[model samples]
Target chain A: MTAMTAPQTAPAPALIAAERVRKTFPLPQDHGGVFTVLDEVSCAVAPGEVVALLGRSGSGKSTLLRIMAGLIPASGGRVLSRGAPLRGPNPDVAMVFQSFALLPWLTVQDNVELGLKARAIPREERRKRALAAIDMVGLDGFESAYPKELSGGMQQRVGFARAFVVQPQVLMMDEPCSALDVLTAENLRGEISDLWQAGNFPAQSILLVTHNIEEAVLLADRVLVLGSNPGRIRGEVQIDLARPRDREQPRFKSLVAHIYTVMTHPEADMTRMLAEDNAEVERFRPLPHARAGGISGLLELVVEQGGTVDIPRLAQRLRLDVDDLLPILDAAVLLGFARVVEGHVSVSDDGRAFAEADILRSKELFRQQVLARAPLVAAIAETLRQKRDGTMRAGFFLDLLDEHYPPAEAERQFATAVDWGRYAELFEYEADQERLRLPEPEAVAP
Target chain B: MLLAALAIAAVLAAAGSGIGIGEVGHVALLGLATFARVVVLLAVSTLIWTPVGVAIGFNPRLARLAQPVALLLASFPANFLFPLAALLFIHAGISLNWGGILLMALGAQWYILFNTIAGAMSVPTDLRDMATSMRLRGWRLWRDLIIPGIFPSWVTGGITAAGGAWNASIVAEVVSWGGATLTATGLGAYIADATGRGDWPQIVLGVAMMSAYVVGLNRLVWRRLYRLAESRYRLS
Candidate 1:
């Protein structure tokens, strides 16, 4: 790994280091007594390096970022700043939150001066530094304005000003652009990039958490991708593109595509393991957010576009995030309906046939495919069939997934399963009652 | 012309009956005395309860414990406690003048306490964290965060306490239980004295003066402070 990436092989003088960090939140019942957010995650931010932790919603990138920032502690590992263990809020490390985190009653000047005040800086100096910071962030005339009076972008600028005023050694930003519009986000991103390249800011290094792959590629010197369900580093790419990197460049687009490909398709250890063992396949990796309509609609789109399409262009046209679009792509790959390679996804013969078939015939094809290929759906069907009433609580499946994934992700995965099961006419879901029942053999078929 | 003639005639008749200009000096002085007692009682309540109220407000368990107990205490009528206070004052031979203020405070202080507790709770966790991270502790922490956080609540409490104080004076001053009577010289005592003597005109005069004082104070002082507190100390 060191030989491939263009950087010093040995660890350089580090600004902030997190070694084998693990964070686990306690579950209510003490079943396992823990819910793992990140497991055995090791990373170091050498001086002058901006590292981006890029992951989707449940990937726990923000948790990892906070642990490194000393905002939260890791359950099992050491987080050090300049070789000192971080026991609490470190003055050397400041965080800019996505929510702006400004006290509503405080003026812009007061909000910017808060960290300094906390550090017990004298009045005259705190005021001077705060004003300078406000000016630096282009908020000069708005010193007395309250947070409630400011626009979202202006409030975020105040957030930036607050962090910058502290002159921290390590600045951690948790998706600072996430709450702003596209244009506003782009504008802020450009300003930060300018500050970073010009060495105009105090922090020697920054730890940025973002889900947008393009943002990660655009801002970071290196990007770390975390896998879901006990988030651990899945892949790391050192972005070697020159400073002021043009988004229109082929190299930039290719890098974005590379990150997208890695995000959408992880090495399917569960699939490989299940294929090898062929026993108790229900205990395989938890389901993705693959709804029946999205899966079928994606297949239909792939078939219509000559059975092949550019993944990025397809995502842009469909207006689906990689987080949303990846699961559908993964489901297609799982059911042998499509094969995704490089930056393109192509439909298989069965997928093409399903696209050509009538709605009833397509659902019939879907039922056969899901029951044969997807273990979770088959387990639900089997469990419902075994019950005397041919029904079970939806919570039964949810709890099973929760034992492996986070409770939220488990709930979402089970909902996806319910949607697929219902659309395929294998199971009937009563949402208001939250019960799943096997469909009765119909007297009249449509 | 008839309305003006009738008003002048009514004024002349009232003065001639000794229920007019002569009583204004006496009634106005009595109103001032009662106003002074209300002010003193409010000061004492502020000094005693601000810290206590803020303390209970910040502590969840303490706030929960105190809520029902304070409400219970506040709901217990001040008139019901007059007998016990009356007995003590008579046995100790304590002057009724200053003692009436204690009864006034008793009737009023809980309003301040509960309001401060509410304000203390509403101080957002982020502001507290900002203080802690800044290493602000002890008096500075209280001065910067707790006081400002409770200011709006304190103003609300003060308004209610002042109103309660005025009402309590009617019962507090000129306390009577069975055969004994303890009297304090104020509008309340004046009212009681007139009632005992069956002087309906004096009773109306004392009541009208007390209402004027309470309403005037609320309009001139509290309304302004409440507005300032809402703008300055409210942590949205």
Candidate 2:
């Protein structure tokens, strides 16, 4: 909140800005509702500043970026570019997509020339500018190569070259390095930092969406942290560090740690935050998209770190994006296996036992914890026990869940429940029949 | 009706009949005419259905309604229309040469429509967003993004449509209504005429010659285009 308000005092006009943006997508007809992806989120990117929108999977950061670029319209509020309302695609911006999005059939030269061609630049000038842009990205020798022929790293160079060729006022990138190998991603990140320091970057400002906390700390002058479950701005941080920032510096490490804290704050505490922000509290706890194995693996790592570990360091050590690690952490917390406090994760007593126990003992302990802590699994087991035949169709649960969740989310919740229940030996599922039933012995015993 | 005729012809072929090596030149000429007809029909189908299919596919709701309708139309036995088309041609005084092209197109055009729809749908959402952000519109958008995006599927549809058109020509090139029969100068007409006279050896020769043309055209042209699509235009 402080960072959001402080930026309003700046004298320079924002190159791209969003005013209380709200975006909703209609669910399938049978679901009978709309899913709110972003709610009353406001942020701005000023000239000569690199801003990073950071959040996990449900954060809607990418959706917000698209809305600002005017690729899609916000359901409510409006987007402003250069102090004017943007009606269609913003004319003063260029984008690099995470998927590289290069036309597979076009040569590298032609792909870089695509924006120029659209602007009706003459052929001779388009060719010259394209070559210069291609050369700037270190892709001079492969002008005739198709995107499919290039490696992922080289393909992204083309993505960069294409965007840079247009020389838009603001450049937007959606997880540009996410699709590359780790080494390639690192190399590209270093190059970007270098380019920013040299001050010859084609775009005056950059707005990138990323799930990497370290990436935000390294590349962005201002980092806006987004919260999930109807994503809104959770907090903002200003990096006052100088150029060619050192990752090993204590200040840099602390900023990374601070963002991890903001992101990993519990959802229960978020209820009060939601109240203050005047947004609806999420009544149903959506299951984190994590598997039992991943949850246990995360618990083992925590226990190995002497029952507690700093998350950013752990994430750095494991080479995981915040997107990959948060779900597993959420699952562990949901089952009472681990806890996160002030960016530090500590393995609970049960988590230690589960991590150290033999396979059979671990399964028994997992069953006990799931029945005691997981409401959806407990409800499923209780309903199966009450049924005379101990059998029910999965769609019955899906319909019940649809009252609270969209159809896709309802299906995912049912799937997670099935995985947890089956692992606990509380039920069995036949996918071909779409049926759920208690185990034969358990049904007969009751 | 055509199956019964072929079954009778099979029986006639079981009896002894002699064929001449000298017949090759004449059969080859007829094959060239039919080959030309298949190429021309395919080009026309490409021109018409590519745009229509792309339009349908780009709108997902529209595609859902259009796809099944297209499949249903393609499944209708095109030969069922021949007699009606023949009657219209006789009354209207139109040449069977041109009328035959329309009849063949009936069975073949749907292939391009459906394939183009699938291709348009498969163009990655990310690419579309990039295009929109870059402000690529109108002719620039089609030339740079949409056309290349759908090229591979278009080639695939074309191969199947050409195969269907060549098969349809056997019935399409010769149309009969009641006692009236119209014949066009192509390998399909030659085979139909040979079968009507129960000239078993000529029937076999004409069938072999048509098969040679279809297989050769696929090998020489369609296969090359398919390879180019696989190499250059395939989306990762």
Model 1: share of real contacts kept:
0.27
Candidate with maximal lDDT: 2
Per-prediction DockQ: 0.20, 0.74
Q: Which stretches of candidate 1 lie over 4 Å from their true place?
A: A1-11, A268-285, A331-336, A353-356, A372-407, A426-446, B1-236
- For candidate 2 chain B, the 10 contiguous residues with the lowest summed lDDT are B7-16
Candidate 1 chain B, run of 10 with poorest lDDT: B1-10
lDDT by residue for model 2 over A63-169, one digit each (tens)? 99999999888999999989999999998899988999999888999999999988999999999999999998899999999888899999999999999999999
Candidate 1 lDDT tens digits, A1-446: 22123223327767777888999986643376577789898887887889998988778898887777665678998987777887876656777777776776679998898778767899999999999999999999999999888999999999889889888887888889988998999899999998899977778888898888878988999988777767877778889999897899999887888876666553544545556674643445566678878888998998888889989888888977677888888888777788887668999987887777898888888888888888888889999999999999998887777665556766777887888888889899998899999887781135
Tell me how far the alpha carbon of residue A440 in candidate 2 is from the true structure, in angstroms, after superposition. 4.2
Error of 1 at B229 (Å): 8.7
Residue A414's C-alpha lDDT in candidate 1?
87
lDDT of each: 0.80, 0.85
lDDT of 2 at A409: 80
Task: Say what the RMSD of model 2 is.
Answer: 4.6
